[model samples]
Target chain A: MAAMIERINVLIQYKDLLRELVVRDVKLKYRRSFLGYLWSILSPLLIMIVMTIVFSQMFDRGIDNFPVYLLTGSALFEFVNSSTHMAMYSVLDNSALLKKIYVPKYIFTLAKITSSVVDLVFSMGALFLVMLVTRAHFSLYMLLIPVVVIQIYLFACGLGFLLSAANVFFRDVQYIYNAFTTAWMYLTPIFYPIEMLDKMEWVRWIITHLNPMYYYIQHFRDLVLYGRFTDAAIFWGGWLFSFVVLFIGLFVFKKTQDKFILYV
Target chain B: MSEEYIVDVENMTIRFNLASEKVDNLKEYFIKLIKHELMFQEFLALKDVNLKVKAGEAWGLIGINGSGKSTLLKAICGILKPYKGTIRTVGTIAPLIELGAGFDMNMTARENVFLNGTVLGHSRKFMQEHYDEIIGFAELENFQDVPIKNFSSGMQARLGFAIATMVKPDILVVDEILSVGDYQFQQKCYGRMNEMLQGGTTLLYVSHDINSVKDLCDHAIWLDHGVVKKSGLVEEVAAEYMNENR
Candidate 1:
């Protein structure tokens, strides 16, 4: 924990460096692409449309403006998903940075986590406009943004540190990691509301308690769409899990950082 | 009996575990993850190595490409850990292992220097205050605003080396980075080392340049297969290492 605190101080000290790296990362994907920034806005909208159609047809529920529901889930899940994926590879992607520079290793993941927030912020703006037109109430729970972002950020940073280390020695993690995200999405209560999980109490409880994404998305819905006030239990659960994942994630990265230069 | 010692490395060895798959593919990796048994084939990069250098001392590590010269430098800087033994250093340590690392190529030269300097452990205030001196040292005043991606590797090397060595650390770790800087700048670097020595900074330099080793180093160590094969005054140690290699 003392080490974690020291690393946090390092991140704060080098905040500008992290910001510069985040800007470069965001630009690299956009600049390399033909469409530039439009890809960020368009891709999520496109995925939401396809998901709405596909899932509506599969579930036989006529999709009932499922576009909005799918948009919310997609928006939230993509934020978490990209955050996690980037966090996992942040160390690997910045191996040169890792090898040469002597700062807290977590800053790499922190940069990724911050970049995920940027992506989230961009798409969520578009999501907000759509929700406004569709008459979804903008509840005060939306103030939960700061708290929820921390939840996702902590979990992402934790896994980012963990996966980046594994990636150094194992080349194949980047690929299997992609598939894991897809499967991981279904495990959380994202596309469908939690009420839909009424019949399967056991699965519902696990999704709520065990899945970190569940808290991330649920926290958002509780404040944004659901109109229900924040629950003490969910808030604390998310807080605790975030720190735990963060603790182990950073520990693994620091312990393994030395070996990366050799493996890479 | 020499009383002064700035860098002390005691019996350091580093071993790396080689995992099974050399190629990266999703299918094979997932399969291996499910197997529950991942055996690490191990190899040692460095073996028992020991040395001590005091304040104002300039030393060089010389070896062939595959020898653990870089590994030993990293160990001394505390960036790497040894499977056995201990490494101790006094004062703030800065490593110039690879020039232009942690530098975002997309950013302007000024921005990169700021971030790079910060990672190298200079405060933002210090970077700001010394900003002019830094640009002057790198000699990129005309193009400080330009992105480094557009610059040549030589330009990048000049800028990075200038920024790293700018700190004037008590203990400075230099690898083969001098090779990247051109002839004039190499002389400049030699001059810079002399200035640091005047200011009382200990130097640990690693290079293939026997001439530079003979000229700049007070002491030299010959590393062969990660062991300190020879250690003594620069001429004798370098002569022995160069003869053996030749």
Candidate 2:
């Protein structure tokens, strides 16, 4: 054994702790709710119906089988949104454990991100059934799921790790994150498409360039509605961006997590 | 370094910010952020605190509420990194910092034990192997399937303690976790603590329970206002502490 320990080694050791915590999070959530896990898919369905109707009028391009189109975005976008929001609150929520044990503090944030992805799996199944019934063209590109899932997981974990750790010290990060996610929904092409952004001459391309969510929403749009794999540039670029954000988030989180026991 | 001392905290200093008195002071906020001055130190929780705990040693830290006892334990556990100084420990460190710290109330007692055991540094396989032992120690055999939220504070504490000590942490850092459980459970805990001590686990106990300290500890340290006032044999130090306060 080396005298100096690598962080990666510690992270690997604590992976089991992360899994156990994620399981508890998922089980604990549905324990009391009347509908339990069904709400994962049902809520998306309700939102998708309303969004399809709303966006169809706004864009005037009325997608055939628009509900399924809306479902694709709703299901995919929910994973990103829920993961970030849950991650922001996770450290605060797990304060009791956090102050006691010194496992990677980021594990709590990752656990929230993981649980949201599990719910995302459910949301995807609901969309798949809708697509099958509607007879939409499904293709081999759907196999690109492993790529998409990994990208979204890294993307959400990065953002969640950053926001949750920030929430520990800044206190206002929680409120700001809540507001940012809601406002961020309109800014992303979830309900709309790339065509809308093309019309906005005043909005800089820089905005989408900076936001990783834009790339993810685009990949989601490509996979489900268009029955195509995302552009190779997007698949790689989005992952690279997520990767960098994860490192940055980890640096910030490790530096500040010690202060959480007091603030939280 | 290997003579028997399991814990070595040298000049450990912990600083934490107090909740702001002024909510609308954006001026203060920007100034603090920009200055980031070390001297602007908002609150000093622990300062130059040093100690050593040898193998099979049961040492207790006694102080009034908010006297930095918990802060010291946390600093030793690496939950709070000291602004100055180092804490080097041998073997695994299990901190029973909060009674139900890692537990989710909405999950079953059984569910929490596995998860809680993991947080205390036990592998899931280790948990699988020791599942029966942990539940047996907690005396939660019949109610393993029930959500922990329905259990009383004492039951929760017992479960937390059982899972925490199950890993046989080389150095156990406990902070006021004993107060939550009833007398019987506390007795069970004391027996467990004694067993761990006999097996050569270093115990770092932080509590306001003077008698508990007097009974279990071979050495006692009195922490007042983030600094140590006394550190010596249990009887003399505890007597001095009692006299100073009285």
Candidate 3:
């Protein structure tokens, strides 16, 4: 407990640097593009359009609010996918600064995640517009969306810490993660309903029970598209999985951080 | 444990593992791992090092390449964790190990001043309070809006130097940063450092140029092969190091 408190204090002390790093990430990301912040919204909208056109006719079951369904899955999954990929390079990218001075090492990962969260927030604006166009109802349960967002953030942050630390020692972790996310996306049932695989219930059960992103994305769709909370089992399971991954991420990052300077 | 010793290092050791061969991808690494073919050779960067720096004392570290001078400075600055000992630092530390290290090349000079200032742990309000002073000192009044990538290396160094030293740090770790920039700007930096020294900031400086060490330091240590070969008054140690190297 004392160690946790001390770590929090260290984070509080370096808050300004963390803020600056996040700002730099956000600014540099959009600086080269002509549309700047608009790309955050447009890119996802464009993807949703392409995927909806490509997959709608084949997989559209009796699902209501198909646009919101597609938007929620793609937006939230992109949050985890792109955020973790960016976080993997956070420490290695700042090797020059790491060798020069002492700042809390985790700040880099946290900053990268925060920048992605900013992009995610902007994309939420696009989600709201889609909800209006599709005439989706906003229930009181929609307030629960914030809770789901926090869970996803924690999940991404945990993976961020773990991947950034590992990448410092092993340069190939980035490529491996790229391949992993591509396969993982198909397994998560982003564009189609799991019932389409009812013939393969065992595969559906594995995806539903085992994959954390399945839980996160499912909760997101429940709150936004279905207008309700996930069942108690899944709600608590998602939170538990997020915290466990966060625990492991912090554990590995703290244990291996001191050696990062030597490796990088 | 004395109150006057602002920097204390005792029995500190730093070791690095250099991988024997190139394994660029994880496939090769995993193959080596399963076959027990992975190998690492341990390199001791600093061995059983002990040092103390009192408040207001300016010390120079003189050494040939690969003698662990920069490693010692980094250890003091808390950049590298020591393998086997304790380092107790009593005050705020600013390490000028490399100039413009935290900069984003696409940002304008004005933006990086704030960015670098925050990276050095200064608050936004603190930067706001000293922004003009930093610009004035760097002589970058006209180049504020220009992207730093377009600036010459010396100009970037000047901006880095100006922001880093704008406030008096309680303990400063400088690593060969003064050797860059034009001669006139170099003299100006030296002048500012002298003023800071007069104001009682403890300084740990590492340099290859013996003349600057002799002129700027009151005490010195000569490190050779990861150990301190000689340490004492600046003149005595400088003479010993010069005689040995020559």
Q: Which interface RMSD does candidate 1 score?
A: 3.1
lDDT of 2 by residue, B1-246 (tens): 634668888888887765444322345566766876323436888889889877778889987888898888877787788889888888888877575668777788888878887787678898999999989998989999999889998888888888888877788888778888888888989998988888888888877878999888899888899999888899999999889889
Candidate 1 lDDT over B70-176, as tens digits, reads: 87887787667789988777888877757567677778898888778877767778888888888998899999989899998778888887887788898888888
| Per-model DockQ against the true two-chain complex | 0.40, 0.56, 0.68
| Stretches > 4 Å off in candidate 3 | B22-25, B34-39
- Per-residue alpha-carbon lDDT of candidate 2 for residues A116-227, written as tens digits (9 for 90 to 100): 8889898888888778878988877778776778888887888888888776666776676678878877776666655666767545374467667777767776877788
Off by over 4 Å in 1: A1-13, A27-29, A32-68, A197-209, B1-4, B17-44, B242-246
Ten contiguous residues with the weakest lDDT in model 3 chain A: A58-67
Residue A128, candidate 2: Cα error in Å is 0.9
Instruction: Write model 3 residue lDDT over A124-231, tens digit each, in one string.
Output: 888998998888898888888889889999999999999999898888888889999998999987888878878998889889888998898889888888888788
Q: Give the poorly placed runs of model 2, Cα more than 4 Å off.
A: A1-5, A57-65, A204-208, B1-4, B18-28, B31-42
Interface RMSD (Å), each candidate? 3.1, 3.0, 1.7
lDDT of 1 at A174: 79
Error at A9, model 2, angstroms? 2.2
What's the C-alpha lDDT at position A122 in model 3? 82
Residue A213 Cα positional deviation in candidate 3, in Å, after optimal superposition: 1.3
